[model samples]
Target: METRIFFNPGDSIANIHDYNEAVRQGQIFKRERHSDDLVIAKGPGDEEYAIFYAKDAVKNPGKGQKPYDVKNTL
Candidate 1:
């Protein structure tokens, strides 16, 4: 299992709702052989999930990690 640290927990808390909506819409974008997931909403918090946006993305340095990012075409 990979660990996703909120890039900024403050922002995470502030935009969690939107994150949840994206997830609901199946808008959670994931890259191939990458651990970056795109954030596509801006709402409140959903404990079920949190995001680490691309503004300051620190890749896993290897294959298969799970954080948050942007650049969605869906």
Candidate 2:
């Protein structure tokens, strides 16, 4: 099964490890990859953002690897 990971800004209490752990622990919200891109819903009254990872995103997590803007094609 394909799984999708989600991270929120400033959801970490400690370092980056803790941040990821928090995400794994449900401190942040996440959902499985149901389509080409995941349509994420933000907090109440907030705008929605789509998170997507290219095929090589896992190989390269740095900039230029993932699509920052959902509307723009990667």
Candidate 3:
């Protein structure tokens, strides 16, 4: 499985809602929110994507060997 991340400088809630709608409309496979700053969505294929939100910026978790941790920040 391959994973990717996307950043959107918009309301996290709205973003999540959009993903949920997509899932409902059969546009995506699944979408989930791990935290206030993290949301995960899966595509029809083997692709997984995530969206990470920070105060004024949106960040992608990016490809990593393991799940990115959002609790600890410097």
Candidate 4:
């Protein structure tokens, strides 16, 4: 049996028994998004929890191609 470990961004600990069990049983599927990796897990009462990982770092917004001013506007 291959032990697949998934990291939950919300929780620092990696060994979440419930999540591991769910994944092992194919109840939940891990999906990756453009900005971050997502762990989609099914919760009780038809509720779902999405845990995001590897969040994009905050970047400084540089000057735009065109200056923002009344004169620059055409």
Model 2 Cα shift for residue 17 (angstroms): 29
Candidates arranged by lDDT, highest first? 1, 3, 2, 4
Deviation in Å, model 3, residue 65 alpha carbon: 20
lDDT of 2 at 16: 24
lDDT of 3 by residue, 1-74 (tens): 43343334233232233444533433222234333433444322323332334342324443332332232111
lDDT of 1 by residue, 1-74 (tens): 33333244444422434544655444433443343444442212333344444553444533433344332322
Q: Which ranges in model 3 have alpha carbons more than 4 Å from their true place?
A: 11-14, 17-21, 25-74
TM-score-based ranking: 1, 4, 3, 2
Q: Which of candidates 2 and 3 reaches a greater TM-score?
A: 3
lDDT of 4 by residue, 3-63 (tens): 1223332342122335445343232333222233433333222233323232321123233
State the lDDT at 60 in candidate 2: 26
TM-score for each model: 0.28, 0.16, 0.19, 0.19
Q: In candidate 4, which residue pairs clash? A: none
| Candidate 2 lDDT score relative to the true structure | 0.29
Error at 10, model 2, angstroms = 23
Which is better, 1 or 2, measured by TM-score? 1
Where does candidate 1 stray beyond 4 Å?
Answer: 13-22, 25-46, 58-74
Query: How would you encode candidate 2's per-residue C-alpha lDDT over 1-74 as one tens digit per residue?
Result: 33333334223222222323433433233343232422222222233333322232243234333322222212
